[model samples]
Each structure stands twice: as C-alpha cells, then as structure tokens.
Target: MAARSKVMQLFKALHRTRKEVFKGDDDALEAARQNINAEFRNNLTESSPEKITELLKFGTDVEIILRKTVIQGVHTDHNRISIKPRKEILLDNVPFNHNPTIKDT
Candidate 1:
C-alpha cells in the first residue's frame, strides 16, 4: 500500500515537471505526457517493493534533471532566440573545473 502511494506521487510529480519544462510546445508536451504514461504503464504490474522503490528514485531523479537542465528557447527573430530558464536551473551555478572558469575570464 505504501509503495503504491509513492508510485502515484512520483508519477504526478513527473508530469508536473514535464509541464513546466515543456511549456508552450504542444508537440514536446504531448510526447512527454505519452512517455511518462508509458513508463508507468510498463511497471503497472510491479510487485516487488525493492524494485518499485528503485524505480521511484529514478523517477524522482529524472524529474529533477528535467526541471533543472531543460531550457526552453523561443524563436523571435531570424538571428535571435529567447530563452526562459527555470529558476531551478539558474539557481545552480556550477562552473566547470578549469583553471580559468568563465567567472575568472
């Protein structure tokens, strides 16, 4: 019973993240929706608690990755595009491990 609740929570959270990550794009949104549904449906008969827990963790990680790493770019002009990054992405400013990072330059 507990595992079932967790599964539903993770599933819904992933969908919400998908909406924010793929906003304003019908094709991408539909694809994401289908993918999420398919993944959960694939595991609908899962009866192993350990395996379900592992899958839940993976789903949670995926949601985080989508929210933090996915950026939406909108076409504006022929040479210019606009980006609206989610706050989750901009909040983490991890620079590469180089002697001279962008901040130093």
Candidate 2:
C-alpha cells in the first residue's frame, strides 16, 4: 500500500511539473502526458520493491531535470512561478510592431 501511494505521489508530481514546463506548447505537453502514462502503465506489472524504488528515483531525476533545465521559458523559485520572456523579446530594442506600413523612403 505504501509503495502504491509513493508511486501515485510521483505521478502527481510529474504531471504538475509537465503542466508548468510545457505551458505554451500543446504538442510537447500532450507528448509528455502520453509518455508519462505509458511508462507508468508499462511498469505496472513489476512486483519487486527494489525495481520500483529504482523506477521512482529515475522519475524524480527526470522531473528535476525537466523543471530546472529542459524548459527555460518558465522560471520557478521557492514555489513561485514566473514566465520568462523569449530572448528576442528581451534583446530587441524596438517596440513590438503589429502592422508594418512601409513609408516612402
């Protein structure tokens, strides 16, 4: 029972991380959701405690990497989430131009 609960907690954590990391990209979000579900489902038959622990460790590592490095758009600090603007947006000096009308030069 404890092992099952641990797995459930890990699954929830992974889903939350996925939600934060892939906020804007629908394709990446769906892919991550499918992959996470598939991996857990594939391992459902494993009965050994040692293997389950290893799997849980791997999931935690993946979550850490995804949250800390993979998705650079979202910044998380002490449970707070901040959206980071893209490099172009930060580097460009000109204000965003919605419509460019060519004036006679």
RMSD values for the candidates in order, in angstroms, are 5.3, 13.7
RMSD of 2: 13.7
At residue 79, candidate 2 shows an lDDT of: 78
Best-matching candidate per TM-score? 1
lDDT by residue (2-73, candidate 1, tens digit) is: 888989899899999999899899999999999999999999998988899899999999998898899999
**How close to the true structure is residue 8 of candidate 1, measured as C-alpha lDDT?**
89
- The clash count for each model shown is 0, 0
What's the TM-score of every candidate structure? Answer: 0.81, 0.68
Q: What's the distance in Å from true for residue 37, model 1?
A: 0.1
| CA lDDT scores, all candidates in order | 0.90, 0.85
